[model samples]
Target: MNIVCIAWGSLLWKPGPLKLASGWHPGGPLLPLEFARDSDDSAELALVLCPGVPLVPTYWAYVDAPDLDTARAMLAAREKITPGHPESIGSIPAIDGAPVQQEIAAWLRGRRIDAAIWTALPPKFAGVGGRMPSAEEAVGLLSRLSGETRAAAEFYLRRTPPHIDTRYRRLVEARLGWRPLREAAVTCPA
Candidate 1:
């Protein structure tokens, strides 16, 4: 059975204990990624896909997760989704639709890669009664943050997937009205 973990966020930069192979694609079907969720450990805003403007592009990486159950457990643990929702690993093309996922899937298969555990759970409800925040609301919340909280927010904005969109990045940066977080990782390297 094929088992590969899909990474479109921090996993792109830090794979944690999963030991995923090194390499990635500037993935597509730009999903509506937003910093609508709060980080329980860090107390800051983090990225999570939710229904919104499909502007942010996605990035994908093939990680080594030999066991399907283990892969789900690891991702759920990392994404902080406990008692994982009924649709945790829901379906591929599940959210992005068949065509988009098919394009990406076929591309991977052509290279002899099949992502059996394709992707992380959405961050929408990742938190305890967490609500997905809007771009404007996010910007407003960001504008009020200070210190480490603010830094954590910046790291999140910079690390998300596909590839960074400078326009949107600039918009977020402009909203915060502060210099971007120092060139540092929001998450530790594995």
Candidate 2:
């Protein structure tokens, strides 16, 4: 099967064990992406697909896996999602008729990609009860980060692909003065 992995966040820059047969290509699929998940690992508001939010462009790359299950497992491992929480990783052969999934299915059919997988971690904040954070709230969280945590967040924001701009990204840029690093210095953070 021609499986591919879609990404819009850290996976692009820090793909740990996802075997990519090719580099990321633009025009993957437009989804409602936002920095909504407060990640424990990165200590930043990690990006996630948020329903009803503005759709943003994403990137996709060919996975070296043999089938959808393998691809999903690889992505789950890369994202540190455990097996029990299978919902955290989304696959093209979805269970429900989610509009976003339908849109992605069409995109996959158009590209002749047999299957696709993506990080489907939900939006989470400390006291929000699973609701996504607003741009203002996200910036408030970022503002409170210090030391390496702050630097890592800044690095993550700067390293994201320019075309993956989302509402929260703009707010972070405006409020925290964090912009995408110049192309010449796009290397991973130290």
Candidate 3:
């Protein structure tokens, strides 16, 4: 196949595909690329790539696709990105023709998968020099938030990997403390 869709987050596990893919690869860099960005649908923060930030351990998978347009359109729809923003889809340059999969791996090692999902939240994420709040700053932001916003941040933190950064984890846990909200009792509809 000459084209393939690269996945970094939830798309890694659950890819909403219109057609069955030919194959997939399990690739991980010692430090996965990650950046924090705002979400329109969930109304919370999302981990994406921000330019200039240190990368973290993460996974990216490549799915076989021979047709570029089909792969790009389907991946864009899956990401909920608006049409017309092909750059946001984050495909590598066409380069005349498809490069070998091994070459793709080399390119990914130095670049971040973080793309422009929601343009309103932050800037300088993709290249020209914008970056997300540092881990400490983000933790503080989460601490200040309440309700679903705070809860969502905590939930995502707990779910993601590279959590061994206890200092960062501690800040997030301490600032945006989380607890299960229990109902008065298990009251059933009569």
Q: Pick the candidate with the highest lDDT.
A: 2
In angstroms, the error of model 3 at 81 is 1.3
Residue range 1-190, candidate 2, lDDT tens digits: 8888888888887789999988877777898888898887677678888888888888888899988778888888998889888878888776354234655777887577787888887799874547888788889999999999999888887888776788888989888898887761223222
Model 3 TM-score on a 0 to 1 scale: 0.58
Rank by TM-score (best first): 2, 1, 3
CA RMSD, predictions in order: 5.3, 3.6, 9.6
Candidate 3 residue runs with Cα over 4 Å from true position = 17-26, 29-32, 95-131, 163-190
TM-scores for all predictions: 0.67, 0.90, 0.58
Ranking by lDDT: 2, 1, 3
Q: Number of clashing pairs, model 2?
A: 0
**Candidate 2 lDDT score at position 94:** 64
Per-residue lDDT over 1-190 for candidate 3, one digit per residue giving the tens place of the 0 to 100 score: 3444543444543467524343334344333234355455553445554444444443444344456566667776777767655556544544235332333355455555421111112332223234555667666656677888666666555544432223444555566554212321112123
Q: How close is candidate 2 to the true structure, as a TM-score?
A: 0.90
Q: RMSD of model 1, in Å?
A: 5.3
How many clashing pairs per prediction, in order? 2, 0, 7
Clashes of 3: 7
- Record all residue pairs in model 1 with backbone atoms less than 3 Å apart, i.e. clashing: 58-162, 59-162
